[model samples]
Target: MSASSSRPSYAAVLRLSHARRTFGAALLGRLSYGTVSLAMMLAVNRATGSYVVAGTVMALFGVMSVLLSPARAALVDRYGPRRALGPMAMSYASLLAVLAAVSWRPGAPVALVAGAAVAAGACTPPLGPTMRAVWGEVVRDKALLQRAYGLDGVAEEVLFVSGPLVVGGLLRFAPPAAGVALSAVLVASGTLAFVSSPVVRGVRPTPAVKSARRPRGGRALLQPVVVAGGVGLSLGAVDLLVVAFAEQRHHGDDVVAWVLAALSAGSALGGLLNGAFEWRTNARVRLPLLAAGLGLALAAAGLAPGLLALTVAVACAGLFVAPALTTAYLIADESAPPGFRTQAGAWVNTAVNAGGSAGAATVGLLVTHAPLGLCFALAGTVALLAAAVPAGSRMPTPTTA
Candidate 1:
């Protein structure tokens, strides 16, 4: 495929008025949450002059967020985004203020900052799932939802990359207090804007959970959400591979950032192009093919003879990343019984997080003994499995109807 052959058409997706406002607010406001871990670490390390304390504090915050997300998402599923997320965002914003104020002091109390982080993480609105749910309500069209999810996948990638960069910049030029404060403002403001958007408020839960049906309750191996997360597991190895490759080659920090950024940039573009097309293919069929593509591309990345080859390979692999994720959401949302969409979304998030964490650990250990290509090979192999996971399994046509 030529370079110019894949440009995405963003017109149709962005044409919807409701999606425009909600997506814009959510994406912009999300930067604070996205950047918080790094910014908080930078703040604490700068203020207390200790990386140990900084790491510990952020670790508590992250672990709690990952652990608490499901329950919070369940709540949103139960009460709806407006009632659940609005209050949660406000309280989160308040706590962030306190955290920022306290962390700025000469010797901030460890317990207090930790407590604030815990509170914020536990109450943090499950917006990732919420947004997908909202898109269904506002767009009310299957094709558009695919586009929405595609845009969403791109936003997620961008958030992860830009969040750290934003914090890094603040740490270099601005005070840690400023970064924390800005994050608080962003969180509060974003939540309010998103929750208040007509699209989000209009979201209605699928009928009751009692009426909803799925294979093996929500934990089935063949479930779309589960398979999607397996993709996350495979892709997680991509980052570790990039870092390891950069280090093995003795590239500097700039190259490290650029290499990682390449994956995200590629994913962003792929998502755009993927969403642009209205495919005739079934979701189940598409899922595995995309996963296979991702796996093979990543494998090629590992085998690249040089930096240029690796860049092209990584970019090629990224082309499938967001589409795979969007398809997972499509399947999961379809598979979710009436009224359980939010919980299903949370589960997807959980599976991805858990899988990614585990893959990173495994890759890190193996990198010490194996060639970098071996890591890529492992990722590709797992991705192939992820593809097979839903191939013959019980699956309905992915649809909101």
Candidate 2:
């Protein structure tokens, strides 16, 4: 047996030196991402009194954030997280604060709000990528690292689900801008604690010569990126399709929420299970299989007889979501050259977001004209096609650092 006699638990992963403090602080900072989207959109809509303006501003914000992520992560790879992440977080938080102030009341200048959003988005810290890289440094054991990534994925799923609920609760007592203000504080304080951790302090910048020697091309990333993008596209279509399904069947809007909750529940469970055991096959082979399973499940969802069956099918599709993403991150990390891991992870992150955005837009158009079942099939087919990307034979074995 290659691994230790004792299987590494999630508890064991956290038990690694400095893992708890570092991971907790990183989650604290990442929570800002989950909150800021809903908060800012509400703020912009209220201040401008136009969904058009709000949507456009958010589009700019999201596009800048997603497109520039790899560039930001590359900075971290070059200068290390401590040196690179601090300034980015501070600038991002400051911009959020400015946007909050500008949006505190109705009739704020539209140009000023849009400018602030673009700047804030561009400066958004690559916290997720940075923290994943830190996990690489803190836990050298391969099995433990797998658990760490699983735990991280599950926690992130929870944060995203809860963050919007928190904002919804807050809207009862405070203005939407208050949520934005809170997001600013969260990122600022969390980043401070994160950079101060002992383990993070030890992750020094890669030497210039070593960085120069690593391959800069995208060949190693082809498999994971394509699968991740496909997964994103499929999931993105699910949200709108579910809504259309509900409305067509005379179900209320709240049904959408319940169904989506089931999906999240399935994903959380799958992530936990994915980490609990070691697999004989490495991530390269597992990646496409997980993606294909998702595609099949989603396509079957279109054939569901009623809301109950659709919910079940969607939940089944969600089972593959977290593990597929976790596996993609693993492949991205393993395939990355020395000093390039952060950028590699960021590329995968970027693909997911970009694909999701495209999927939502494309589905939005198609849902209006086509049969709901056909639209669902089209989305699932995207993932199926991506799964066909060949996993080359000469893949690296998963190894401890």
List lDDT for all candidates, in order.
0.75, 0.87
TM-score of each: 0.88, 0.95
TM-score of 2: 0.95
User: How close is each model in CA RMSD to the real structure?
Assistant: 5.2, 3.7
Error of 1 at 106 (Å): 5.0
lDDT of 2 by residue, 346-390 (tens): 888998988889898899999999999998899889989988887
Query: Which pairs clash in model 1?
Result: 206-339
Per-residue lDDT tens digits for candidate 1, residues 1-401, read 01111223455566665657888888867778777777677777766677887877776777777767777877777778888888878887787788888888658777777788778777777778888776655555667677778888888888888887787777777778667788888888888899888767677545454434455334332555556666778777877888888888888767767776788888899898888887999987888899889888887887898888888898888888888888877777766666667766766777777677768778878988999898898887888777777444553322221
Error of 2 at 216 (Å): 8.9
Best by lDDT: 2
Highest TM-score against the true fold, candidate: 2
| Model 2: colliding residue pairs | none
Single out the weakest 10-residue window by summed lDDT for candidate 1.
Answer: 1-10
Steric clash count of candidate 2: 0
